[model samples]
Target chain A: MKTKIFGAATLWLLACGPAAAESITWWVPNWDEEAARELVASYEEANPGYDVEIVITTWDTMAQRILTAMSGNNPPDLITELQSRIVLYASRDMLTDVTDWFDRDLAREDFIDSALATGTFDGRLYAVPFRHDGSGLIYNRDMFEDAGLDPEQPPRTWEEFVSFGEALTVEQNNVITQYGTAWPFGNLDNAVVRYLQLLYDGGGTFFNADRTGVELDSPAAIDAMQRLTDTILTNGIAPRSSLEIDNTGLRELFANERIAMFKGGPFDVDPLVDAGMNIGTATLPGTGGIGTTTVDGFSVLVPGRANNPEAAWQFAAFIAQPDSQTRLTATFPANRIAAENERFSAPLLQPFLAQLDEGVPKPSAEGWGEMQRILFDHMQSILLGSATVEDAMMSANEEINALF
Target chain B: MKRSTPRRGFLARLRTDKDGEWAPFVLPALFVSVLLTVYPVGSLVWTSLTNIGPDGVQFVGFANYVELFQMPRFARILGNTIVWTLLTTLGALILGCVAAVALEHRAVVLPGVWRAILLLPWIVPQVASATTWKWFYSSEFGMLNHMLMTVGIIDAPVAWLSSALVVLPAVALVQIWSTFPFVMLMVSAGLQSVDESVLEAARLSGAGPWQEFRDIVVPSLRGVLFIVSLVIVVWALNSFTIIWVITQGGPAGRSSIFSIYVYESFRNFDLHRSAAASVVLLVASLIFAIAYMARLRRQS
Candidate 1:
């Protein structure tokens, strides 16, 4: 009688154990930790017997950690990473091909084209983008009024951008107490992105038509380089401190009223508002009108070697939904329907959204990391007056092409 | 009263045999070293001979090394590494020796307190101090520039980290600051061992402070100086935290060294190139490490 009872219990456990509890690990950056935990809790509540584990990563260590993880046999079932990094992993065949799942569950037309493009490499989607944004003109409204310029009208052309910068600049005792604008020329990544914003705005492409090599020495690129360097070197409208700061430092300068304007993203709005500063936002000015901004964002990817691909996909698909995206995104959601939610309708964010209309995805070529470093070095040469814009761009073009 | 003899165990034999005893005791450490150090290093060397990428790993012989050498910036990066290592090592040695000697002077008051105060830079965490130094070196809002300008030393702010011309030295200064205290402590210990009779004889011979320091103090601390210099040279060659935190080898690779390049290559997923660079750095560091080991063995 005892043996029969024990056998009956063992049989029941064997039949129902896995069905009763299934767990999947999700690696997310610290910035998304709280939101991801809340989402995981909600997901667990809605679906019985499903568990999503959250592993917090950090900006400084995430790239190296992810590379190490993906190269190994074991990896988290899901990862929330930068969209720009998707191609690098997908090219390695380290990510699951989510194209079919995306098609079956999410509406293709509802997502932004550029955001989707970041996850698409070699004509297959490997990730589901949740958040997307591009840089816009984030300015101080009171500084604008103080400069005697119309606070309502931001620069719509590159020429006006320079002129307005000059007008807003404050000089006292020849020390230049305050500057008109500044650039994030210190950090290699931020410097490259800022330069790319100008390069794209002026109708220059980073790669040739076939995407085989760089076209940094093109007329459009040289023009962009000259205009960007001229802000500090020739025009003297910006402070020399531009070379010592990144985007975050630029925001602090703007907050302290040290500079009048800078190129920033929608995420800067809340912090600036919270600091009690009256700010204005506008699309980046181009040679003609609204310029192109480099679109980058976060996406959820399933590692190719994930233990639970099916369950990870279900959670990923659920997160891609409009409501989930709205809750997850710190910036604008990749889903157009979710972007239309009342939370994103604020005036400060509208310009960033408008900028997104002309946004181009950042280059995701295999050697882009090394290529960007080359470009950043040459750009620095121009800013430091060690090399001319033409010479520096020509060198950058050659060096980058040599990599290919 | 003949009793049955108890059998001796292997451990008992090992403990009894003095010469062979250490082998058993050292075997675990030897095994750990082989597992941790030799295996990883051998793997790195093998990886350096292959191309690792998204496609797959392909054995490419010396292609990675050839490619690294052929790169346009290789020479500049190598030159930067040598200069940075030398600058930081020499700067730390001189500054530390001087500080140690100063604290040892008879006129000095509360030498311990002064030594402790001077040693603060070394005691502070590299990340924290380097970050603070980065802000302090800022051209616009930095206290260094502000103080210089306020003192009428210069009419304008100096771009300590922005200009390629000044960036390497700027970062090297921070390296020197963080490491000199170690040199000071070593020299201070060495200073205590200098024979007092020789110094008294020199003073009785009417030797001035400069002569005494140059002849007696300098000669007495040669071994300490030699060992300290080798240790610091090794540290400088392997230096990453200060440079990485302060400049990230930037403003156009003006301050990039071997370690920075290795890290950058690794971050870019060019693992093969990173491995090759690591081997190069390992070979370079091995030269000093071998000398250090030889000196230690000779002393022992």
Candidate 2:
């Protein structure tokens, strides 16, 4: 019996060793612990021969960590990365060119054109998008009903939005009791991106057709920023104080019913639901009959130097499978067919799915950090009364032009 | 003063110290210091001259330095660093001196209790303190607004952290509270050494309390004060955790200091620029360090 036990233990140790097994290091930005663990278990069950070591990372550290790892000889086989980081890694010739690996459906019909286009630069594909997220307006159903507006009908136009927002603003004794909306403004620079989305939705493009010029000097872009700022600061609907609160604090207030509506994404969904809000979700109201919002999420990229590039690609492609994606992530898959199915869609996400056309990709550029800085600086100037809408947009254009 | 070196030849000394195990005793620590401190600093200076980032780096000489001066964001960050350092140090200094002077007075009651209470802020972990301040600064249902409004001093709740003005002061307050204890401890030590005979003599000779402080106390405590100032300068210059946790230099990038800016560059995958920014911060700190050393030399 002792001999049998010793032999079994030795066999287990041999199987566990890296030399014996084709172990792939998969890096992911940290998320729900239990859910991630469950998904990993399912994957391990499915792929019996292959072992997946899921390396969890934080958002703040992800970019630097991945880059440092890649610079080293023994980098991870596969990495789930941010779109921002993907562009950086791809620019450096660190990622494996995935042109041959991409399936026909992934190229032609399964994936949306713009979403697929974001992962590729110039001519070669460098990454595959894992999950997608962007912004939308989450309103209080009770607050809308109390304000005498139909909760069922959400705002579709900029005019209707302003009017509804005005009706919801509650003030007494020169103090706001309930704010109409908390469009987070100032300091944090998240507000700047939201302003860009507003600008985009207003038929304003930050760049020209060739992705070379700075056209943010246009009147439409100027008007979009001005309207957003005025609505928050000058106008009584959205509070200027919302500018002070960071994203987390603002979300908390929105959850706690202090704010009637919030500009947020799916990450805020479950939290709001847990907080007991009668949530009425809708796409961002637009000026030119089309809505736009900023998209933020991870991409999968294989490093250039891999012990097993084929195995890495296989594992990556496996996770990105439509069925696998639907099972794992809270996000709608890049696969268009997966999106059309109610089987893949969760209950709270029905509204986001309905307004799928509103999901426009944010502009891709080599020096995105610099571009974001210019965009953020102008947006703040608009809030601080240092610059008018036109001036701010023009400033952004000039700065970005100098950069890109 | 105690060394006995009577007519010993160099050969005799060499023989006396020959094959000494002191090499084994001190070499490990010396080697560690060389590895940890010397090597990294040398590399840091080298990195500052290079375009080190996610992509491969190449030697850029002083281009990073030239760009540092040219970048408006760098200027903003520099100005922020100066203001934040000055404000935090000045605030910490003033409050600490006052508390120390107050504690020096024997007429003050419950000195032990007061000392314990004062140390409370410093005793808490920095992360915990920062997180608490973040909650305190929250606009909706924040402890600050709640307490202020409940006192009936203000009819409406003010957003304590959203406005640029309020956030700076609130962050400063947290730092002030956390840091004053160190200064107080130092000052109190310095104060005890202030000769009681000298104070009594001054009082007997018609020196007022102000005169005693300005003349006797000031001159006597100058050494401690100088040391304290140096420490505060370094702390204030690098102090980012409290502000980072509380505001993260936001509400329109109003509070982006040098340290925070370095972090931003790193976050944005521009660590080459971050390294360059770090050199600028290092130079600023080096100036203070040199000044502190000069003061120490002057005292000696």
Lowest summed lDDT window (length 10), candidate 2 chain A: A1-10
Q: Give per-residue CA lDDT, model 1, range A102-124, as digits (tens).
A: 77556677889999999999999
State the TM-score for model 1. 0.92
CAPRI category for model 1: medium
B1-300, model 1: which lDDT tens digit per residue? 999999989878777876766786879999999999999999999999999654678899999999999988899899899899899999999999999988987899999999999999999999999989988998877889889998999898899999888889999999999999999999999999999999999999999989998999899899889999988988888899988887778788899999999999998888899999999999988998899899989999
Candidate 2, clashing residue pairs? A186-B251, A186-B252, A187-B250, A187-B251, A187-B252, A188-B251, A244-B162
Q: On residues A196-301, what C-alpha lDDT tens digit does candidate 2 reach at each position?
A: 7887787888778898876788887778877888787677677766655667767877877777887777778888887778898887777744477766566678
**Candidate 1: stretches off by over 4 Å:** A1-21, B1-24, B53-55
DockQ of each: 0.62, 0.42
